[model samples]
Target: MSTTTPAKVTVITHPLVQHKLTLMRKKESSTNSFRRLLGELSTLMAYEITRDMPLQDLEIETPMEKMTGKVIDGKKQVLVSILRAGNGFLDGMLNVIPGARIGHIGLYRDPETLQPVEYYFKMPSEMQERDIIVVDPMLATGNSAVAAVERLKQLQPRSIKFVCLLAAPEGVATMQKMHPDVPIFTAAIDRELNDHGYIMPGLGDAGDRIFGTK
Candidate 1:
């Protein structure tokens, strides 16, 4: 196995993930449909990414006899939502990993500066010992996602993986160069970024649909 951290991102292109992603990508998709699809897509992708989590065997008493059971080992995994958009992905992930601890970091871009600014932050205590999965729906500019990871590092989590709904290659490249130690998992990696820095053919803003607010 490679000792180095994975810099590459695995786009969860499974049929179900792809179908839902396609629906969300359409300009004709309504807010309710987009929001519902995003949640479902997150659950599908999260399952694949979390498949290899270490498990420990435990002996259990059954009605007929004693049996062996497997349970996740080590500390509970931490799922951090990078604000409004991230919350969309976080909801589905939480459904799958109901017992996993959750964290939230709210970052928004400033109008004139076009810089990511943190509006709120909270993370599990003793996070250094747990696996961390930071989530956001869109990685358009990568500013907020990068900033969120930078902040998480200050707490020194054992390991971190970023999960997003869609990513532009530019954003992926930026994150790869800035924090090569972090691996990214996204549902789709779009072709390019427009001059305005939005992912080309990207779905409308994830936050708006998820919360039904502008």
Candidate 2:
């Protein structure tokens, strides 16, 4: 939300998205409710994220007559999950874009250094022709997101976007400094990150909440 930064960060202010996010953030929110809300929220967010996807004119026959209509080719789009937490966003997005290819990058934050350590990565072929949308629940430190994007750039995808449930100003700034070309979309932008690399007032440890690990 900082105006001084050049990063193309969009804070989704849709009423439904904000409502579900509030439900997900409550400490008393059960794992089931939290997970369900995340899926519903992701579906809403996908609507905004893919708003400008390139559309082509297609002739289609309706009940009465044939007409030209705009259509998006789902095959040219890919959703890349940033490991365990990112998978949570998959179901909802897939509901909207069922034909989109899926990819995964396994990364864990180094406890001591607060950096990302990649353990696995798998992507679909012909990535150069696909527009990539990277999903992760929280962008707190931004190290993992940065590292993941750096790796994906090697595949040279046509375009890339990062979507998350929440983001911290520090994370936004870090991403701006590192990968300004990749736009970031999030439900809300929190104030800042705590010393432990957790977003203040953020839904704590998204992976834990999603999986009930904690």
Candidate 3:
């Protein structure tokens, strides 16, 4: 007999997430609407990703009496945006955890190789003590996510989680294979990537849709 552990992928089927995602996917959705929805959706997804974050009790005085309240413990968290599209996720996540440190990694795919090439990289100091969450709107080919994680690993953060609005099966598999320890949280997983490495039925180029650019 053989046993196997399932891949660490979380598909957020929450009704709100599903509904907003549908709106964003429509070809007729306006840029303002699409960008607004992404912000809202990112907040919902952020809630799920940090569900297990550690907390410590603090003694506080209520209006009527003293009480013990729970607050997130340890070092402030870090949100690493994978550039361009990833910025969409950052705004909403900051609303949820305003104190979190921000980092950015910019990589563009080489058309011929379909591999990620880093163009910019910056991160907060003391990453070793912080919980890091990497955000990108789409995980289509997985090249960028894998490469981003590979680079983040060098910093040795306390933990790393990847969050996206949509993911293709190939992308999920690639991340799991390359960095199995990093969990993935997404609103949905579409069928597969098309020949050009775009997720079928995806919301199109997220960076373009969000910014109303070609």
**Which predicted model would earn the best lDDT?**
2
TM-score to true structure, per model: 0.92, 0.96, 0.95
Candidate 3 has an lDDT of: 0.90
In model 1, pairs of residues that clash are none
Ordered from best to worst lDDT, the candidate numbers read 2, 3, 1
Clashing pairs in 2: none
Error of 2 at 184 (Å): 0.6
RMSD of each: 2.2, 2.7, 2.8
Candidate 2 to truth, TM:
0.96
lDDT of each: 0.83, 0.94, 0.90
Candidate 2 lDDT score relative to the true structure = 0.94
**Residue 146's lDDT in candidate 1:** 86
What RMSD value applies to candidate 2?
2.7
Which tens-of-lDDT digit does each residue in 1-214 have in candidate 2?
A: 2245465789999999999999999999999999999999999999999999999999999999999999899999999999899999999999889899999999999999999999999999999999999999999999999999999999999999999999999888888888888899999999888889999899899999999999
Task: State the displacement of the C-alpha of residue 200, model 2, in Å, after optimal TM-score superposition.
Answer: 0.6
lDDT score at residue 51, model 3, on the 0-100 scale: 93
Q: Order of candidates by TM-score, top first?
A: 2, 3, 1
Name the lDDT value of residue 212 in candidate 2.
95
- Name the regions of candidate 3 deviating beyond 4 angstroms: 1-7, 73-75
